[model samples]
Target: MAQTPQQRRANERFAKNEAAKRGRGSTIKPKQVTKSPVSAGWVVVLAFVVCGGLLLELLRIVPELWTSIAAMLSRLTG
Candidate 1:
């Protein structure tokens, strides 16, 4: 459903007022922001560990590809 022009204007005004109120505040409430989709250095390290585990499984299935995978990862990182 779409809002009427007047309804949209009222909402815009409300948002502006809310923003101004937030801007004027010196303390109390923290900023409202979305949590990171993937957060922290440790999370990235964990992701790498999971990927390495998957690759290890793949290497066991296709042992001949280990050298190629190592070279690929080295080239990718470098």
Candidate 2:
């Protein structure tokens, strides 16, 4: 379907108005946003806390396990 002459003129007027607005710098440039380094730091801190807790749990369990194994070994050998 072809646009009528009136529709064509109206489209041209809209395009020209848009161009004029841009030429006059009616729009502002958006500011560059900076992300905080604190989020990365928090991630590292959380990893350390979780790993430390796991290590502590293992440390608590391993000695008791070792003693039990050693006693069984001694009884078997004796």
Candidate 3:
């Protein structure tokens, strides 16, 4: 079956597009990942600071725990 002029032009345009797509190589470039500004030494220091804070908090709670235990023991004895 003979196509209309418009249909023929559309088919030609489609084939030309397909050929153009096949003729080209990949134009995409690889993405580069950026490293963090903070170094490993800084990370270690931050971890140490956090751990030191936790240790100090634990130390602060120890005296309260001892007082509570003493109160319980006195109540039990009385």
Candidate 4:
């Protein structure tokens, strides 16, 4: 059976990949990924900044929250 151009190209790619897997023909190397230690440090810093901001917000709202709770309790009791 005659193969179309696309089918022939696909067959060539398949053969190349198979050859690479078997350590034959032109071997294709996978790209390597390397992470930077500085990036991990920056991630930790960002987490601390976010946590600090949330803590500050909670601290700022505590006084108002206490007032609201006190008023609610007075209404319920008196």
Candidate 5:
């Protein structure tokens, strides 16, 4: 048995309508409020500490930047 093109089109239209109806009535999520001052301060402090540690580790591996600081000064003087 072969399905006609009209039947397939009807089925596709029905599926689209079903999806749109469900999307409109989807569950709503409550807004998240970061209202804790103590926890927020700790979060900001830890972010800076982690970023600073990674930067130092990169500077250790790429020591040329540290050494180049002296070279740059010498070039300026020369």
Candidate 6:
């Protein structure tokens, strides 16, 4: 059987009252302070190492990219 609109409204009002009653007992817990496992100097060093590796890889690929571009241009012109 289907419920009438009045029954649905009664259920909504009952839920709202129950939720408001439960909301009054809430307390906030203090947040804990934590320290980093690695030092700041190590983090900076790791960043530089990663950047240097990327730079080296880019330098190695640039010449091959230029060669590929040249090949494409030659094919287009021919």
Judging by TM-score against the true structure, name the best candidate. 6
Write the residue-wise lDDT of candidate 1 on 1-78 in tens digits. Answer: 999999999999999999999899677788798888776988989989999999888879786677789899999999
TM-score of each: 0.34, 0.48, 0.55, 0.49, 0.34, 0.56
- Model 5 residue runs over 4 Å out of place are 1-38, 64-78
Encode model 4's per-residue lDDT on 1-67: one tens digit a residue: 9999999999999999898878855567999998776787799999999999999999999999999
Report the Cα lDDT for residue 35, model 5.
73
For candidate 2, write residues 1-78 as lDDT tens digits.
999999999999999999988789566789999988679889999999999999999999999999999999999999
Candidate 1 Cα RMSD after full superposition onto the native fold (Å): 15.1
RMSD of each: 15.1, 6.5, 4.8, 6.9, 9.3, 6.9
For candidate 4, the TM-score is 0.49
lDDT of 3 at 49: 100
TM-score of 2: 0.48
- Cα deviation at 6, candidate 4, in Å, is 38
Best by lDDT: 3
lDDT value for model 3: 0.97
lDDT of 5 by residue, 1-78 (tens): 887999999999999999999889778899998677578779989999999999998988788886899899999999
Model 4 misplaced regions, further than 4 Å: 1-31, 34-38
Evaluated at residue 64, the lDDT of candidate 4 is 96
Worst 10 residues of 3 by lDDT: 25-34
- CA lDDT of each prediction against the hidden true structure: 0.90, 0.95, 0.97, 0.93, 0.90, 0.97
lDDT of 1 at 31: 78
Tens digits of per-residue lDDT, candidate 6, 15-51, equal 9999998988878889998999999999999999999
Q: Higher-lDDT candidate among 3 and 6?
A: 3
Winner on TM-score (4 vs 5): 4
Candidate 6 displacement at residue 3 in angstroms: 35
